[model samples]
Target chain A: AGDAEAGKGKIGLCVACHGTDGKGIMPMYPNLNGQNATYLESALKAYRDGNRTGGTAPIMAPMAANLSDQDIADIAAYYSQL
Target chain B: AGDAEAGKGKIGLCVACHGTDGKGIMPMYPNLNGQNATYLESALKAYRDGNRTGGTAPIMAPMAANLSDQDIADIAAYYSQL
Candidate 1:
């Protein structure tokens, strides 16, 4: 759960929107810094599987679709520590 | 968004920890229904101005320092119309 290095590579695309610090670039983006890992995983999966919707969903869907389970886990772990 | 009956009476202490359709009944509590009423009033004024900590921030800093700014904008417009 502490693999920040691996998560960095996997979540590279997210930085454009979520910011490298995970503080979110805008109010519309949502600061993920210090968010719970379990919650992050659930939300990401929801976005991937079409359970959640928003202006960001279209962009997120494709990005989430390409991630493996491990990738998702690692990213969540990394963001939790941010 | 629309107001949900004065945010169900000023959130009523957030339903003992977010429930009744806002989702989060557990897992560290964080559903907030549909969310996004200016990001739930910027995360409840960043947990009532302490800059957002975990463990529920000492019961959400005395319930958001007694909420008055139109009751946090009508409970963030009633949880963004959850």
Candidate 2:
């Protein structure tokens, strides 16, 4: 449902914590490598909408707030595959 | 890899926070509904082994500490399909 190539190009904002390989850079961060695409998409949407909160939500909400559905989908696709 | 029925029987400890429907009862708690099974299993294992830290780790660690791999798998399976 999303273009992974496009997602890869759009990952600049994510790489610092999530890493280029989708593995979290820190212990507190959850790993995204091989995660579920649908789950990722929903999580991103929830973040963008300010529906998901707590833990890293404060950090993630601002980052995800501007993402379009397509952006969320692409990012999800990119990360789900590792 | 896991029996949902078996997992269903093991959810007593999880229901207080996660709910019987796998949806988290509180915003700070993550909803386990339809989450990725592999991710859930790994996360439970991480909590049990004290490899995952920060946020709710202190609370989760003790809860997950005694779970066998089979218990983790069954729980994962149960939550993943919710």
Candidate 3:
């Protein structure tokens, strides 16, 4: 797990669709709160590396591209805590 | 719009993740029941054409590749009705 404090600041990109609470704004977006951090990190990494290939990847892939390994761990840590 | 009766036969590929009722098998898999028909069709098309690139596309894209426009519409109609 990475620092939750560091992740809080970088989560703005996620709040628009996944929500500030990670509950999500639509049925298509899916919830992120309380999800497994390892799963979340892997998913983010997949999107960043062009492995994840779904309709919503365009929006999420760019966001993942902006994160570092530590940032992914931090973001996953923050959401998993919620 | 498509024939709901026709859609019933084409939804098997979706049942593993989305369930027979389109409710989804896991938290990571989103529910598809009662969602907008148009949204479902568009989502499927997006997955088919490789425009919806997301984590789950790998599973869904290949399935969508086998479906026609009518198949998509019918499947969407079936799920939206559920």
Q: Supply candidate 3's per-residue lDDT for A76.
A: 85
Native-interface RMSD of candidate 1: 9.8
Please give the lDDT score at residue A77 for candidate 3. 82
TM-scores for the candidates: 0.59, 0.55, 0.57
Give one digit per residue, the lDDT tens place, for model 2 in B10-64. 9889999888887666544776766667668877886787654555667888999
Cα distance off (Å), candidate 2, residue B23: 0.9
lDDT tens digits by residue: candidate 1, A1-82: 4367799888877989887788666655666766667677766776677654444556677889877768888998888787
Scoring each candidate complex against the real one, what DockQ results? 0.12, 0.08, 0.17
Better of 2 and 3 by lDDT: 2
Deviation of model 1 at B17, angstroms: 2.7
Better of 1 and 2 by TM-score: 1
Docking quality tier of candidate 3?
Answer: incorrect
How large is the interface RMSD of each prediction? Answer: 9.8, 9.3, 5.5
Please report the candidate that would top lDDT against the real structure.
Answer: 2
lDDT of 3 by residue, B1-82 (tens): 6888899999888888777887657745656666667667767887788764556767778989989999999998898787
Q: Candidate 1's residue-wise lDDT over B32-70, tens digit each?
A: 665556667755765676654444556676889888767
Interface RMSD of 3: 5.5
